[model samples]
Target: MLPVMAETLSQLVADSFEIAWDYLEATGELGNPDIAANHLLDTIEAMIRCGERRRLLLSNNAITAYQRFRAEQPLSLAS
Candidate 1:
């Protein structure tokens, strides 16, 4: 159970980071790519830390519910 929880959280964090990075690139608002890259890295780090804390606090049932909901969602072509 512990390992499963950890793995799920890790995957979620990675997915979030990818989504953020893709969004930033799509917007093309980053005038200074280097600065934006640094900011994105920092944001992802913080998101991971927050996700870890939330994972610890969430109940198994909550996690299961999230998994079910995610599974039910239609796949996006843009992804």
Candidate 2:
């Protein structure tokens, strides 16, 4: 599992907007098909990039934490 990462409130809002836009487009309710299609493509790309960055950040943070934990432990085991 990846380390916990916090997302800004704005990200949450943007996700909601994306979901709504997708729904509208799927239902044939979106006006200005050409413009909306372009915007949708852009938004999808941005969202994909954002997710990639988040995953990378979380993985880095987890590795850092694990290294710190190992460094702080003594070299002896007690049974």
Candidate 3:
């Protein structure tokens, strides 16, 4: 039972991460795809572990968290 639940949760987190990553990529607001990917995965995983099961909600919140993190960093001169 526990293994099944873990697998489901893993799938949920992966789906949420994809949704958030795609949205950010589409917006073209990300300065670094690698950094954004890490942030989205971490945020989504944490949210899932805390009992957030709604896919869209997790994606949206992860996007928002990444945006906030980007905002705090120094402006990058790279393309």
Candidate 4:
């Protein structure tokens, strides 16, 4: 049971990251070197660790986090 639950949670995180990453890529907001992608995944995982389970909510929060991060570190984007 614990393993199953862990797997589901992992899936949720992956899905959320994918959703946010795809949106950023589509909007040309994602940068190179995978920094943006890594940030998105980190944000999503953190949210999950905080008990967030909904896929859309996780993705949305991650996207917002990424935007905020970018604002604070513009150099994260590609040249």
Candidate 5:
């Protein structure tokens, strides 16, 4: 759970992604190829990308930039 100050989707998703990554990285969960965690990462990225687009914050292919570094570049694999 997040603090009251972290009510926004951006804040919650960003913090959850970072915290989960920290735990996984410190415990080698990332190396184990856990699909759940990977999906969580993907979900966070999706939320950020969607939020940005909805808020008209997208520009210069800045939306989901890291997703390009992942799979074969999902142009529109759902928001």
Candidate 6:
């Protein structure tokens, strides 16, 4: 079980709505895409990269899920 932010990964899905709400408030900007969280996608990506640097594999399931996520809505720089 991946311990993330004081909770197991399973809790994250349950907490996503609250996370999105908090994220919306902090960013001071709102839109359909939750662009702030979109920006934080790098935090997720960086975690994966650092794992690789340590010779760790981000489990196949995680990689596949993330790929599906990114493929669903690929991110690009605004400018």
Best candidate according to TM-score: 3
Q: Rate the local accuracy (lDDT) of all candidates.
A: 0.45, 0.47, 0.84, 0.81, 0.47, 0.40
Give per-model TM-scores. 0.39, 0.34, 0.82, 0.80, 0.37, 0.26
Which regions of candidate 3 deviate over 4 angstroms? Answer: 1-7, 77-79
Candidate 1 per-residue lDDT over residues 6-79, each given as its tens digit: 45655654555555545546655333455444554455456466544343223222333333443455544112
What's model 1's TM-score?
Answer: 0.39
The sequence of per-residue lDDT tens digits that candidate 3 reaches over residues 1-79 is 4545444887888899889888888888666877887789999989888988999999999999988888888887212
Off by over 4 Å in 1: 1-14, 51-79
Worst 10-residue lDDT window, candidate 3:
1-10
Residue-by-residue lDDT tens digits, candidate 6, 1-79: 9866555443443244344435445654323345434544443445445543221222322333433455566346221
Better of 4 and 5 by TM-score: 4
Report the C-alpha lDDT of model 5 over 55-79, residue by residue, as the tens digit: 2222212223333333443434322
Task: List the pairs of residues colliding in candidate 5.
Answer: none
The residue pairs that clash in candidate 4, if any, are none
Backbone collision count in every prediction? 0, 0, 0, 0, 0, 0
In Å, residue 68's CA in model 6 sits off its true spot by: 28
Tell how far residue 4 is off in model 2, in angstroms. 1.6
What shift in Å separates residue 73 of candidate 1 from its native position after superposition? Answer: 38
Name the TM-score of candidate 6. 0.26
- The superposed Cα distance between candidate 6 and the true structure at residue 37, in angstroms, equals 2.7
RMSD to the native, candidate 4?
A: 4.0
Q: Rank the models by lDDT, top first.
A: 3, 4, 2, 5, 1, 6
